[model samples]
Target: MATSSSQTLALQRNSSEQNRFMEKLMSKIFSFYDEQSLIDVTFKVSNPTALVPAHRLILAAASPYFENLFNGNQGTDPIIEINDIDSDIFERLITFCYTGQALITVDNVAAMLNAAIVLQMDDAKNRIVEYLMTRIDEYTLQSAYTLEHETKCEVLKQKIIEYETQNFIKISQSDEFLNFGAEKLQRILVSDNLNISREEDAFDAIQRWYNYDVPTRQQQLPLLIDCLRLTQFKVDFLMTHIQPLPGCELLAFKAVSWIREPTVRPMTNMRFTEPRGVSATNCGEKTILAVCSELNPKLQQYNKTEDKWQEYASINIDYGGYRTILKNDNLLFIGGWKSCATFNIVRSWNIRNKTWQNLPGMIQARRSHCVVELDDKIYAIGGRDGLSSVERYTTSDGWKLVNSLIDGRYDAGAVTLNGKIYIMGGYKIHNDKTNFYMDEHLQIKSVECYNPDSNTWTSCADMKLFHSSPGVAAHKGHIYVLGRGDEYSHVCVERYDPQQNTWSQICSLDVDPGYIACVLLDNKLWAIGGQSESAGKSCVSVFDEENFCWVERCLLPERKVCNCFVVPETLLFSM
Candidate 1:
């Protein structure tokens, strides 16, 4: 171990002083540009007859290309011929080596970048990249992309790639997207980061690109189409949108068959790489459906595009504790019973096949249980059994018992957020030894969290008031509990911050909607389908983040009982 004295450790003027000294030295060296007394080299540019005088020592020191040129010269003329670059751009490159600043403009920035690459002046190239980034727009985006490839500017290329991905729908419609050569077009098309909500948009863009110059681009269709995830699209979307295009019959046939059986994968040559960045499949015009009510097997879906609720699907399932959830294109009905004996049946309606399939039933016949999907597995936790048991189910694996809850609860609210499942206030049987049956069934505010990674349960901050069948949802790492705090002021919206390990009521409902269905969609909170003063009317309210209040939105077409989970387009299904 060594220690320095206080006087020796004292810092002043620092690196700035050394930079100033170097600047003065460089300034003195540059002052001899016009003096031929010690001149050793002359640089010339073509197309405009521009000549600049320079010393070999300064030029060679600043550029490796120049250093090798001057050291391996075949003649003593002390002259260098720089061609294919504009004189103005070349002058800026040389000036940057001396002053550490390059004059950048819209007209000359691209050419300056090219010149900087030739001279290997990284500082000048970076400054030019910054300038181009600030000036990027719809008109200049194509040129920036072109310059990215020519200069091998990775920073600029990354920016351009991001810009294109975020604005894929916008850029696909532009003329520049159509004119990009096959190689460049292939690069953009293969990127899963393209911000398109629908696979049809990607298909449409490829068609337009092919149509732009049909005779010239027809041969490149196989290369271009191979980059699309054709199997991801619905059968109807394939037939309606992609099949009609010329030269699409073979691909369309494959897509249709793949939709029927996703197991039949595409040939290696035709298969596309999985999406590479943030998923683009989460947004679109989607419908929310309310399924089988207490008495009726009829199902209804909210058609957002048409602004109507239409009968979408039907299944003979009872209403009590029967929960419906939508994941990808499938809608699942988990638990709930026509009676105590019939409660364990589980079925799923596939949107692609328009068919229903029965899945492996849960170990316990429980209703009013909480179900949440995480990591492609469905978790059914807490129900009428008043047992702390929890079960997890996956496509490949059947129902497997996981850890039980610390509190034996039924009619509890559970949601998964940030890799943990949160079970909120629910009716639970007290653990009193003497009067257990008499003091059973309590709505407690106690909250518990289940971490799947550790297979353990931990306590969380409880809600302000006790609640039964409270609506709960998780978004952006926060859990929101609705209809839980105050009954008279039924708009009890409490937000739980996991980082702080605390819960606080942020907003309340204007109307007292008891036991409402809560969900977080598109980063907004929604409460739907609950009994209020005006019961029997479909009521919905959304959290207005801008004003910090709950504002009423569209109402359901009919008085639907049960719950609703939102998809891309808000869909409400009743039981």
Candidate 2:
């Protein structure tokens, strides 16, 4: 055993000595090559021709192109002519062959990468790809994308695509994006992973690209426009922007027809209607978004995994009673009141960018209105000042007055189920000649349903008791309304069945009623933050479907009149 151990130790020492010797020998070889000593082969690269000297053995060992050339050659020293590569790129590649190290920078990476691809140096190509990935940005993405096509580098291509998708808005505004060829622009526009809050931005990008070089790009407009999700565009946008663009008449007509009669006519292309990566429907991670009043401008997000609430983005203006709806990644804040003044202003908060934009306002300035999205359109229902008016917003046409409601009421609960919108009990004015002193309003138990296809409203079965400013959510084919009760501490829960046109009392919650926000998440109903008989409540409760009761989940950080909606979790944390 002692003799065997001694032999093993000797063998390890010898192996270590051999490795060090090889390292020294490689360094010497590289030094000689750097000094242009003992050069056996000369490479004459074209495009401002220049001669570069290298050792044949080192070149052959590092690249299969040189190995195959040397194996087929007959002379002791050979002169190789490379017509496609530049002299600087060829010299850099030869340096990589000798030292296994190359200076890769943004200025020359494209040319270097090309030379490496041509020489069949897999190691050099891989290193170049790694460097390119770290350096990819809006300025260099176009060059990288072009190199990807020229070299047929799948890895680089995928990385470029991912970067393009993530920073699409910024890239689209870059000079490189305007200079992109028709094919490259089409490749980006056709991506389902492009992170755009609205499809209008896609159209705007196309228009900008076209306007950059109208004479040359005009012919490609039709093909490029085909890549846009036409169904996602609002009717007004199509009419005002796309319809008059000369060649887009057909697409504009089609988009209008589809928006008006989506069920009547099947989409010409499914890809044009599919949502992008930033869309809530396509996002993998999701969270609950809580929008509080302007006084509490810090937005809150509920992390389901941790079961906690965290502060997210903030808004500048103070707002209350605004109805929020998620359209793709943009959370649309509809009509609401601020400082005793009602507003028709529509503000869009993009979850991906964490930026706010002013969209077209509604026709009616309203607060306490119920907003719901149906068939890719936003509908703002009745609100204060005895309003029975309804307005629908579309990306193509902006906001238009839709069919009026049957009974005008504010602080009503509204939710969508099975392609229809259901509005529950709300306060209504009761103008009586007998009461001469003051205007009287009372909470009513009337329910109405709106069908977008018919553009009409039909009365549904009324609830047992009136509920004003109640939290409403749709779960498992039933509409659940929580909290706003006539009597204090009598906050009742009720479920409405559209199929049977009936309402039933489910259970009562141990929290305040009105101003609560109810949302359907993970196949359950969650009621969050509202006012009670005494003060505002910050507690959150989830419906126990199996037991028909409200279960406490977690509490929010502060008590405020908050509107809760579900959004992609990435929108909350990624920004």
Candidate 3:
């Protein structure tokens, strides 16, 4: 028995050493392939044909297509002719086979996936599909769905379906949703995982799709209507909206019958009748809260769907220069100046209850400071009196000091993006040399970023122009800073790319340059009311990302220096 155990241990040691040897050998082989050394197989790829070299052993091991090709051909160092696949994609796949790494991005993912499928590289195909799954946004969902149909990848199909289910409301509003085929549309409408507020929304989406091209899509309406939970709709809605539709008359009658009689199921193929799994908030309509004045203390809510504004709530205290951050359902009002004095007080208003509660104050009293929320913690950074101190707040632990800024600044535009806090362009107060009591304010164009993981603040690329209390927001993985142009006549909008650590100016705002409040709502950047050259301007404008211009939206109630943020429509109605 002891001899047998010793022999087994020796075999295990040999197996471990063999794995180490194979790993080292593969690494060396990849290095040789990188240098174009020891290349035994060459692929002549079509579509602007290019020759790509690779080792047969690596390709055969990674892909069954190459394995079968190499086994059938007896010749050594054979040049294989490949067609249809782009040369770039084929080269990337060949490199992936050798090095086990591929540069799969949105631009190349579709081509790489198709090439992987053609080459019978299941592993590479799965990786590419997973990459596509992670990036299934409105812009890419249509292409991904098309790829799923072209490649016949069941996993990709299910992933796209699940994304449609989870984001049904948002997806329904997208142009891609209108382009969905009848079969694909039915798959999403039948899903129980759909995050919709009511069954009527599902019907509405179907109606919109049918109306997009009524001549071609009229016949698809009946089949698509079977996917909705008809019993979930109100009797009036069924009669008024569904029954009157050209193709939905039969489904509407069955739905009305099922709603009236609780015991019997509709004698039709409409399987989905129960309510969809809705989230806490109805995502169809969004409510934006704009706090314009401290003295007037009015909280206004703007309904995007209605294109109207109404007074929602009010704050009793008269304060100004405070920053507002909405976390979950709580809107936090952080440090501000009142009666010519700065206070460290922090107050939170529960949008659900419509009540305000005082929380723990900061370590230092600050006004005109930038407050941002990241990783479920709120950070108060750089404020008045040349304050370089920074503090963080959590519900359980209260407020604690974090890393201080490299330079003290107030009225800076701060935003959180990709797990980092960015503070950009503000004013720094410096004492005058001749008059000791007099203070001089200088506009700062410098920028700094804070990383919580490292607990450090690093300098970023400086803005082209100075920004004092400018509007800032993060969108599409980039930080957008809207600075009121001091030198130029237009408002300068610059976008900062974190990966490149660079800032580039995009289209300028059409409104007169001033201290404007910027917020991102419904995937669009909005510049709200701010003091223009003469007075506070009530004009509002939204950035058209595709057109690279700012288009005018609805105006605010009054022309004032106001901060705006998005909230659920339910929050405003709850009051």
Candidate 4:
């Protein structure tokens, strides 16, 4: 909050002088240096050098990330130089060490961008890139494109085009990029060699990848559907040159599948081969939905005849409670149990890479939370901690701050529709300052929704009953709420319609229950896992939409607070 301009100038001048002196002093420590590699130069500025000690300089940079900066060790052998970096970067690096602030400008922006990108400074890189992406125009883009290599040029061009397509004016009428099409991307003066060929062939290649079938490719469909929306309409006449290959429809389906359900989950259990009470649809018609689940730990694909959930590739990551998931063509698992950590660790798993990487640690570590994938970003909602507190993280713009909930609770329900986030129920937030539990219970019944696009929260209609009361799921035109108390829970089902901004009582659940996690399958709503006195039930239960009956199904591997996701075949079912 210090707004003094003179103070800033003095601080900057001093910081710069100190770093330059340090660099100069380091140079003097070792004239035995290799100019090209820059690694042999010594930082003999340790204690007994008769100068301000190296330990002193390091102690100055003692932020938490310093451990990561030093490769997770607080102390290490002094290094003169690091590879693949120059003095220009070194100055900035030293600046970060000297002062925790990094200011952006016309000159150092490019280096800062590169460094942040390399070091996984995701938040910083996004800010720099977004700023550059917006200010640079056609002339600048053309210059960069022409000056850079083909691969790098393509990458920049695609990013600019995407920035434009996603945020700016996109000429939606074009055809080549329509539904897996990429039209003449740049209107440039180029030779024949630079031209792309088999334009229709690209379309054919995409269509074949999805293999559009329900049970088989259903999990993979959402992403493909989203991509289809922004695709520039390619020429129908171009179809003459683009012949549909034998299976190109599937590939095309796969292209759009990117936006379908979003986020591909790593395989947990093996394939599950069976569905309870799958009967002939009146005329000997069999229902085949290749539904994958998070709770059951189904053996891979469980196809008795061929029985294997074919996995082509996998990105190994440490994750659990498969319920907290989000996807905008990228699988982001926000919160999950890690036995080593006191709270759920936050991590991101790129669907394509299959590798899990650590993200910013949550402010309040939690478990059994809900996450939503919107616009290629994630929003983590409430879940109880050792003490319940609400927190969220989004990766789209690199984990920036958003508003938090008015109160904290666990077992709360969350859903995202039309870009707004809605949160319902859980335990009360503990006010350590007051040192008492507020039994008002008034906060528990309320509903609050946050808008990231505007960074604000507004009240919505509250449920007639307790949401933390148990068993909630969202389906076509409604959010189904079930259960009420713990040992004394209710099977009372209520439906919420966001459009009308109203709630209505639906058919009550027909099974024994204490708590339930509900998900929609086909037109029917399925509520699973609630405590009951039923002898044969193992917690897994289903509701008959048409028949209005609840059918108790076979048990999941264990009792769980299941968070269900139904990604159609294209988004996640294995080959």
Q: What C-alpha lDDT, on a 0 to 100 scale, does residue 238 get in candidate 3?
A: 83
Candidate 4 C-alpha lDDT tens digits along 98-134 = 3333566655556666655444433444455555566
Q: Candidate 2, residues 366-411: lDDT per residue as tens digits?
A: 8888888865578999999779999988654578998999999988
* Ten contiguous residues with the weakest lDDT in model 2: 264-273
Cα RMSD, each candidate: 19.0, 24.2, 20.7, 22.8
lDDT values of the candidates?
0.69, 0.77, 0.77, 0.45
Alpha-carbon runs more than 4 Å astray in model 2: 1-275, 294-296, 437-439, 531-537
lDDT of predicted model 3: 0.77
The TM-score obtained by model 1 is: 0.51
Q: On residues 1-575, what C-alpha lDDT tens digit does candidate 3 reach at each position? A: 74474554554557767578779988999889988898887888888889998888888778767877888854364688888899988998888887777899888888888888888776687688888888876337778767877877655665676778888889899988888888667757755567787777887898889999999987777777776777778899889988887778988988887788754542332334445542113334675788777665678788787676777877776668788887656678888987889989998766655566677898899998999887557999999888888999865367999999998999888998766899988888775679766657778889998987678999998988888888889988788888674745667788887655678777677666655777778788888764344454466788876445578766666666557777667657753
Clashing pairs in 2: 234-395, 234-396, 235-396, 235-397, 236-396, 236-397, 237-396, 294-318
- TM-scores vs. true structure, each candidate: 0.51, 0.54, 0.54, 0.43
The 10 consecutive residues of candidate 3 with the worst lDDT sum are 265-274
